[model samples]
Target: MPWKNQSGGPWGSGPKGPWGSGPQPAGPRPPDLEDLLRRGQDRLQQLMPGGHLSGFGIGLVALVIIVIWLFSGVFRVQSEELGIVLRFGKYVRDAQPGLNYHLPYPIETVLLPKALRVNTTSIGMTLVEDPARGNRTIMRDVPEESLMLTGDENIVDVDFTVLWRIKPNGAADYLFNIQNPEGTVKAVAESAMREVIGHSDIQPILTGARTATEQAVQQLMQKTLDHYGSGVLIQQVQMQKVNPPSQVIEAFNDVQNAKIDYERLQNEAQTYANRVVPDAKGRAAKIVQEAEGYKQQAVAEAKGQSARFLKVYDEYVKAKNVTRERIYLETMERILGHSQKLMVDGPAGQGVVPYLPLNELTPHRQTPATTGSARQSSGVTK
Candidate 1:
C-alpha cells in the first residue's frame, strides 16, 4: 500500500498555477515509510512475549539451510556397494547399502565401491601353455609370483596363474584398503605354489597330476588369505608349464623318451611270455604222459611174472621130496646139456678121468654116473 502525505501540497499542479502558500500543513508530516515502521514495531511489542515470535521467524530460515546441507550429504549405497566413511583424515565406520548420512567433508568423507563385485587379480606373469598338450609355459614369472622345487632334489622353474577376487565387504575396503591389492595377490599365490610344489614330484607337476596339485594350492591359498583377514577368495590356480632349464632341455626330452620306451618294451616282453609259456607247458605235459605210460607197462609186466612164480611155488610145496628129486635131476640134465662130461673103464690102468662137470665143480660132490656104475658092477659080481 502506498502511503500518501496527510498535508495537502498541490491538488492541481498540472494547471501550472502556484497559489499563495500562506497556510502550510500542520508541520510537515514525517516520511510515510518511517511512520509505518514505527507503528509496526509498537504493535508487535504490545502482543508478543520477549519478542519471541519475531526471533522465531529469523531462526526458521537458518534451520532450513542447515537441514538442506545435511540432507544433501545423505547418499545411498547400492546392494553390491560398500561405503567407507572418513572423518577428518581418519577412517571411520564402514556402511552398507541404502540411505545413510554422514557429516559433509572436509567435515567427514565417504568412499564407496562395489564390495560384492568380484574383482579379478590375474597373475598375468603366470599363464597356461597349450592345453591340448597339457604343456604350459610361463613367460615372465612375478618371482615374487611363482617359484618351486622338485622331488629330485633340484630347483624347478615353475609358473602359474591365479584367479581371485575380493569377498568380504569390510576386508576389501581395507585390502584395496592397503595399497596394491594386486601385488599382495601375486605374492600370496607364489608363496602358496612354492609350498605345494616343494612337497610334490617334478613329474606330476609337469604332467597329469598338475591339475590336482594346482587345485590343492588354490585351496591352501584361500585359507591363508582368509586368515590374514584379506577378504579374497582363490577362484582357481591354473598350472602353466614346468620346464627344465634351457641347458638341460635335451636331457629332459631324453628322459621322457626313455620312460616311454621302457614301458613299451616291458609290455611287449610280457605279451611274448604270455604267448610262449603255455606252449612250453603243453610240450612238457606230453613228455610226462609218455613217461607215465612206460612206468605203468613195466609195473604190469612185473606183476604178471610175480603171479606165475607164486603159483609154481605153491604147487611145488605140495609134493616136497618127490618134487625135490625130480627138480635135481632136471637141473642136472639141463646143466649137463650145456657142459661136457667123460668116464673111463677101471681096467684101463686105474681109469684116469678126462673131465666131469659135477666132480670138477666140487670135490665134495660125486657124480651119479660114478655111483650107478659102481653099484651095478657090485650087483653083477654078486
Candidate 2:
C-alpha cells in the first residue's frame, strides 16, 4: 500500500497487469547468457591466468561473512569471565569463556563485563590526578573537588583509594543501572570516610589509624553499593596521607615535633631510673657485705682478747703479792730510766750519771728460809 500510487492502484497496471489479467505468465525463457559468460572467463584464465581470481573472490566474500559473524555474537571472554546473554533485550543466560553460539544479533545478543578484574573508586579533598582535570599546568596543583571536612569542622587533606570488582553474574546488565559508577563510588567513599574521620583527631588519622580508616571505607563502600543494588564486591580500601590544610601545616608539624620531644624526655627518665635502680641495689649489697665482714672480724678479735685477759686475771688472783711487786718494780724502773743526765766536760769527752730514787736502800733482813717463804708468798719463787 505504501508503494502504490495515490490513485489506490499499481502504476499503469490498472488495465493490463495485476488488475487486468491478475498477472500474465511468461511465454519463453531467456538464453543462458550468465552461463556462457562464466565459461568464457574460465577459458580465459585457463589460457593465461595471473592469479586465483575465483578463489580470491570467494575468499573475500567469505572474509566479509566471517567478520560480520565475528562481531555479531563471537564474544571472547577471558578465562575468568562469563558472558551474559540477552534475548529480545532481556536477560537470557550466562556463557563461559570459549567458543560459543547464540542467535544472531537483534534476536539474541551478548553483553560482557570483566567478572574477575578489580575496579577502583576514590574520595577525599586532597588533590589527585584525574583525566578530567584541566590543562597540565592547572593539574599540577590541587584538584579543588577532592577536598573534604572532618566532624570537628576542620578542613583536612585526605586522599584514599578503593579496590573492588564486579560480581560474577548480571554485571553487564548492572552497569546500566548507574550513569557514572566511579563518581558514585567516590561520593560514597568520601561521605563514609569523612564521617569516620570527623570522630577522630588529626594525629591518629596521620599516624595510627590508616589501616582502620582504609577498612572502614571499604566496608562503607560495600554497604552503600549493596544498598543501591549494585553487584560489586569490595576488595580493599587504601588510606593515604592525612594532613592538616596548607594554612595550618606548620602548626601540625610543630605539634608532631612536640610529641617527639615528649617521648624523648620520657625515655630519658626511664633510662635514668633503669641505670640508677640497679646501681643503688649493687651499692646497698656491697655495704651490707662489708658490714657483715666487719661484724665477723670484730667478734673473733673480741673473743681472743677476752680469753687472754681471763687467763691473766686468773693468774693474778692466785699470786696477788708477786704480781703487785713485779708490776711496781717494772713501773719504777721505766719511770726512773726514762732520761739519764749527760754531763759534758769538754768537746771530746762525755759522762753519764744515774738518776735513781734512793729513798729505800734497805734490803730484806730475814733468815734465808724466811726469805724464801716470803718470796714464795709474793709469787717470786722462780
Candidate 3:
C-alpha cells in the first residue's frame, strides 16, 4: 500500500486537498483556463501512438479542429424560407432551400426569412379573449388607430387588416432596409387607410363604400411601400369594421331611413305620373279625333245642302213662270191630297145635274145638301 496518513489517503490528502484547497462550497465553480490547458496537453500526449507526441500529431489535431469549424457553417433552409447570404457583414448573394453552406461565422453568415409565407398586419384593433365570460373572443379597439376624420369633417371608427408578403426577389431589401418590418407595415397601412378615409364621406364609409375604401387603401399602401423600398407586396386591404361612432350611429341610421323613405315616395310619385299622364293623354287624343270627325261630317253635310239649293235656284231662274205654275200646282196637290172634298158645278152647268151631290145620292154616303149656299160661298170649282 501507499503511504497513509491520518486522513486515509495516499499522502494525507496534501495541504491543498485533491482539487485545490480544503472542502469547497457546494456551488459550481468556473473552470480555470490554465489548468484545463495543461490537462488537455497531458491527454494529447497519452493519446499518441508512441510514448511521446510529435508535430504530425499536432498537425492531425489541428486538422480535426478545422474540419469541425468548417462543418459549423453548414445549415439547412426550409422550403418556405429563403436564405440571404452575407459575407463580412455585407450582402453577398441569396441561397435556395436546401442544404446550404457559407464560410464560418466570422467570415460569412445567412439570414433565413420566410419569403413564401403570407403575413397579416392589423391597422385598428387587437384580438383578446375573456375567460371570465366563457372565453368569448372580442376585438379590443385602439382608438388612436381606429378613429379617423372624414371629408365631411365627421369622425368615423374604422378597423382593417392588411395582408402582405415579402417579394421573392426583394427579400434582401426586406431584411436589410427595414429594421422593424412589422411595425413599418402597420404604420404604413394605418396611414394609407386614413388617407383614403379622409377623402371619403362618413356615410358612404359606414354604408356602401367599404369595398372602394379597401381598394384605395391597398393601392396607396403598395405605392408607398414600393417608394420606400420595403419590398413588401400588398395582397389585400380588408375592412372589418367601418361605422359611425356609437354616439352618432342612431342619428345616422335615422337619416338613412329618411333618405330611403324619400326615395320611395319619389318613385311612387313617378309611377303615378307614368300611369295617369299616359291615360290622360290618350283620352285627350280620342276627344280631339272625335271633334275632327264631327267637324268633317258637318262641313260635308253643309256643302251638300248648299249645292242642292244652288241647283234648284238655277232651275227657277231659267223658267220663272213655268216654275211658279208647277210649284203652285204641287203646293195645292200636297195640301188637298189627304182631304175629303166634293166637286161643285160651275154656273155654266155642263154636268147632267150640276147642283146634285152625286156621291151623296148613294145610300152609303152622307152629304151636306146646302149646294146653293155652298155655291154662293165657294169662289171656284174644278
Name the top lDDT candidate. Answer: 3
> By how many angstroms RMSD does model 3 differ from the true structure?
17.4
Residue-level lDDT for 310 in candidate 2:
88
Model 1 agreement with the true structure over 275-357: per-residue lDDT tens digits: 99999999999999999999999999999989977876786899878777877898898987654344444566464645456
Candidate 3 residue 142 Cα shift, in angstroms, is: 2.4
lDDT on C-alpha atoms for all candidate structures: 0.61, 0.62, 0.74
Of the two candidates 1 and 3, the one with more favorable TM-score, higher being better, is 3
Give the Å shift of residue 375 in candidate 2: 38
> For candidate 3, what is the lDDT?
0.74
Taking the tens digit of each residue's C-alpha lDDT, what string does model 3 give over 1-382?
Answer: 1111112332222111112123211112223335544555677889876758688766665665567557767878888888776565466888898888877645665667778899988877997898988999987888889999999999998989999999869987776566567888899999998888899888788778888889999999989998998889999988998887878889978988999999999999999999999999999999999999999999999999999778868878999888789878988999987444655555555655646667655646325676556545655345
Flag regions of model 1 displaced more than 4 Å.
1-68, 76-80, 86-100, 106-108, 122-147, 176-179, 312-382
User: Residue 149 of model 3: what lDDT?
Assistant: 96
Alpha-carbon RMSD, each predicted model:
26.1, 18.5, 17.4
Q: Is candidate 1 or candidate 3 better by lDDT?
A: 3
Worst 10 residues of 2 by lDDT: 12-21
Give me the candidate number with maximum TM-score.
3
